[model samples]
Target: MHEFDLIRQIDSFAADHDDVKVGIGDDAAVTSSNAYKDMISCVDTICEGIHFKRSTLHLSDIGYKALAVNLSDIAAMGGTPRYYLVSLGIPAEWDQEEILEIYRGMNDLAKRYGVILIGGDTVSAQNGLMISVTVLGEIETNRSLLRNSARVGDIVFASGTLGASRGGLDLLLSQGLTAHRTEEEKALVIVHQRPDPQVTLGELLKESGFRIALNDISDGLSSEIWELAEASNVCICLEEEKIPISADAIKLFGKQSAYEYALNGGEDFQLVGTVAKTHWPTIQSTAKEKGIRLSAIGSVEHEGDSQVFMQKNGERTRIKRTGYRHG
Candidate 1:
């Protein structure tokens, strides 16, 4: 199919929103926003070889994840996602139906979040398929959650369990796509394919009006904590036992491997950050009422060389960047 025709087909997936003055069919998207609100934007790209393998992942999974990762970024800032634009690098091997399937995947998630499709460009690629997404979000003016806002003597916390995505990736590589026979295996694979961004939890934290510092756990607990410490200029000390690992992760990968995955493995997309020590109880209660898992794993110490440490059995060990990184 021709590029213009393909774009016209993809335009069928766009959603209508009152704020949007112009949508997918234009040179650029025009949208209105509340004067008291601030806009938050983030972009993420996933390539065929670096991000996933065609043999293990479906075309729709690629589309879903490309947008999901960007949503995770907006979530870290405690913003409500509004619109998104997708730029695709199409390889010759993919057909028009496959491309449309990718858009269908993106549209499914967009509808759930009330996000609309804006404008973007599509181009031909020589190597493999690539998808890049840019997401625009809104937050109350001056209320943006930031990584640099953590203060000394603050409590560090994370939402949901960690390391299941890494375990899922391992399973996919070793067992192939159809080999997930058990419930645990299937759960792991599902997490790897479709990560749930903590948008609601982020919004709740913002609504609570607490001064907090947050970073999404895209890389790993250790790496993200290091980012938080560095950005906030504080030392973070974590209790080894407090890190939350799902029972399914432990059951499949064993206790030790599960811990390793929580620390070093990446792509969990959970939020981790610091809050005032005194405010933790109320925050915890509010999150609990909403059925969200918020775990306090550590505390911020006096300002120093921004560093992170893990305490296990009375031994404190300095942590390094051991999570996933692109070369």
Candidate 2:
């Protein structure tokens, strides 16, 4: 009914962890990760209507995504997510059951990932609900992946097919769960509603002894590739044919729109990274063994300047570093 009561109810769902020196019900959460390694921290926030439509998005999904997106940041650095703090701005209109369902979703996901919901604050909002999640993770200082470490001779790769999430959003906006859709179309809607962060794959890359540079594809493939190139001071040349487009996306949006979605659609939550030519074989082999769709889409090379370009047919076209940006 009230703010403190609601916080107490949510806090009861938090799991215990030894590394958490101080957890919920404290002034601030205190965590002690590995002393020898480095700690990675990331924060992400989503507001109703802007990030999700209440007409189609469930409260459980909103809670899951609020944490999943932050976990994606930890995964991009090849780290293990350990702890999280969730802050919410709850509107007065939402019933208590809806509020509890939010934490139920987050607690389930945190349990799956061994993450602890340490502490956070909940406040009243005049209008829509807002969720802000801060995630803390750890990784070996030397093994932590960097976006700018790509080398000229490295091969660029992307994990999983892209653009289905955007297609899903289109369906949700246009149809609102109507019966006149294919199974593939329904699956795309689920992808947009609930995204899976690539944490295990990131761990695999770190443990394989492969030298690499990495970043998760949150904004878009083209934009992320540009970040990798700019950070590593190398030019990336991608073969348009090599970029993996989801079959569902093609069926839903046709070839041209699907490719555009793959190139510029945001929130896919896949990894795009670079591996040296010498280590690409091992990485590719291991990824296949793990049943991960890791595809080589491009190459890193030195040009007059560092940039990203797509090669189609015989023409070379520059890729714009454009993607979804929060205002």
Candidate 3:
């Protein structure tokens, strides 16, 4: 397909919104901002071979995950996503219909969160397909959840289970796409491919009227907690048993391997952060009411070495900052 034809195909996915003055087809996207709120913007890129394999994931899955990962950043900041721009590096082998299917996957998730497609660029690539997404969001002024806000004596909690995404990726790599998968394996694969951003939970935390430190688990739990500690200039101690793991992950990968995934495997996309201890009961209760699973797996301590410790069976060991890192 020609460039304009591809642009037209993408344009069909744009939805009208009051905040977006000019969407696709424009030289630049013009958007209105709320004076009462702070705008949060984040960009993420996923590349073939590096982030995913075309052999395992469908084109639509790649599109969905590309947007989902960016949304997770907005959720980490406790913001409401408003608009996004997508830039694609299209390889010569890809067709127009396949490209449009990617947009369809993105549109499915965008409609759920009321995020509108604005504008972006598409370019020809010689090597592999690459998708870059830029997301813009709004948060209460001065109330954006930050990584550096953790205070001593605060309770550190994580939303949802960890390690499932890593397990899913492993299954895909080992078993191939067409191989038969157990029910648990299927669930894991789904988690890895189409992670649900915890936007509602993030907004709830922001509305709790408490200062909280939040970070999304794009990396593993160990790496994320270490980020929280180092950013906040505090030490964090986590109870291994308190870390939430899906029964599916445990059953499929075994307890030891599952915990390893939780600690070191990346791309779970769950939120992990610290909140004031006194405010924990209220937040936990409210989250439970919303049917969100939250676990207080750790606590923040006075600054020592800005380290993270994992406690297992009465033994405590310092964990290294290890997770998915781009080279």
Candidate 4:
């Protein structure tokens, strides 16, 4: 079958919506946007050996993650994801069944998030399977989150637990799946394989009309904090004791490494944001009502020369670059 044939097969699974002016089979997809809302778009890719190992991760998981990561981007911007374009580089060796399974995974997530598959390109790959997803979203212009909005004296907060994904990856790489491993270990591995984007939490923050700064933790917490501080022209102080470390990470990587994973390990997909000191109480209360685990990790300041630091036991240590980076 030709590339277009395969694309048509995938398109058969997509849902049609009124917002999509043009969808698959066109040269490019067109989506309608609200006049008052700003559009947000981001792209994320997953490769065969680079992003995942076929031996460790299932094809469905790879498909889910390809879309999930882009969802995380929209969440970071406090936007609603509406449409996506998926470009696939598929090797000849991949069978039709495998391809359908991948689309099924993506469709399940898309249905849950109310997103539609608009259109995309496909090509034959000489090497391995690759999926690049471009997601489009929208949010009220005034409520859009920005990396450079953290102000001095703002309280830093992290959504949900951290380090589980990184720890899970490490465990899978080192030990593989074994009968000796406990259920906690298996759960850690699942975290690495499937990450949930915090879209609801981001929407809540935007709707609440609180002045806040937001970024998703695709990179490690340390790297993300540095990015937020540098972009906002402020310094951030993270309390070591305040950082959320998951029990699974501690079980897999031990205490010290668990803390390191929380601070520097990447791909957690959690939300890290800052709120003004005065608004922290209300926002925190609302998050509690929503059953979201929002934890205060630090505070922002304008006095330091450094971008970020970890303070513990009355000692402050400057944190350097400590997350994954593409070459």
In model 4, how large is the Cα lDDT of residue 35?
57
Clashing pairs in 2: 148-231, 148-232
How well is each residue in 85-113 modelled by candidate 4, as lDDT tens digits?
Answer: 99989998878898877777788788888
Model 2, residue 237: C-alpha shift (Å): 0.9
Candidate 2 local lDDT, 105-146, one digit each (tens)? 788778888999998788888889899999988876556777
Q: Is candidate 3 or 4 superior in TM-score?
A: 3
**On residues 184-293, what C-alpha lDDT tens digit does candidate 3 reach at each position?**
99999999878898889989999998989988888788988887887788999999999998778999989999998988887888999899999998999999999998
Give me the runs in candidate 4 sitting further than 4 Å from their true place.
Answer: 1-34, 177-181, 303-306, 324-327
Number of clashing pairs, model 1?
A: 0
Q: Count of backbone clashes for each model?
A: 0, 2, 0, 0
**Clash pairs of candidate 4?**
none
Compose the digit string of candidate 1's lDDT tens values, residues 121-225.
Answer: 778899999999999988877677888789999999999999899898888899888783699988888888888888889889999999989888888899889
Candidates in order have lDDT scores of 0.83, 0.81, 0.85, 0.80
RMSD of 1: 8.9
Task: Supply the TM-score for candidate 3.
Answer: 0.88
